[model samples]
Target: MAEEKFPINIWVNEERYEKLQTAGLADMCEEMLAGLKVIRVYANSAQRDKILQVFPTAKFDSATTKSIELLPREVKDAIFGKVVEKRSIDILEEFLGQY
Candidate 1:
């Protein structure tokens, strides 16, 4: 089975492109660019690079960069909240065990 690929259209500037390059997600960024007009789906990272090679001038938006930056924190917070809740339960169990 092939991995699922989501198509997204976004505008990107040089700063955001640089950030993508720095994070080694340039291929992913390129995939977004290729998705703008092409119906082609990228099945792997290699395909993303190929799409970028074909569409080197694809654009990116700052909002996309901002959202990407924020996504990790949002995910982390959600996971951290669950972890803390679990730890609290464990601590309560330990306390009750002592009694």
Candidate 2:
């Protein structure tokens, strides 16, 4: 049987983007898979807070924030991506595994 693959989609705004970029998340992904795309969206503080609550160890260079949600990847051969509202210490460590 052939192995299945899924496309990843990451949703984040400028503030969050900077955090991820600083942590080298985007760079890591690009290094592993070329031609990957990331989308940015505006998110209010409340929305950002909610996501941050789920990940208390996230770091932020600025007070501003954005919304992010990682869709579950349960279906075979279906495109999916994990959401990241903020760059937490744990998440950063996890991303390091790619190296």
What TM-score goes with each of the models?
0.24, 0.27
The candidate maximizing TM-score is 2
Total clashes, candidate 1?
5
Which portions of model 2 miss their true places by more than 4 Å? 29-99
lDDT of 2: 0.36
Instruction: For residues 17-61, write the lDDT of model 2, one tens digit per residue.
Output: 565676666543322235434543323454345434544553332
lDDT tens digits, residue span 1-99, model 1: 875442222334555455445655455433344543211111234433433343454322235431212223333243223323443212222222322
Model 1 bad stretches (over 4 Å): 1-7, 31-99
Count of backbone clashes, every candidate in sequence: 5, 4
When summed lDDT is taken over every stretch of 10 residues in candidate 1, the lowest stretch is: 36-45
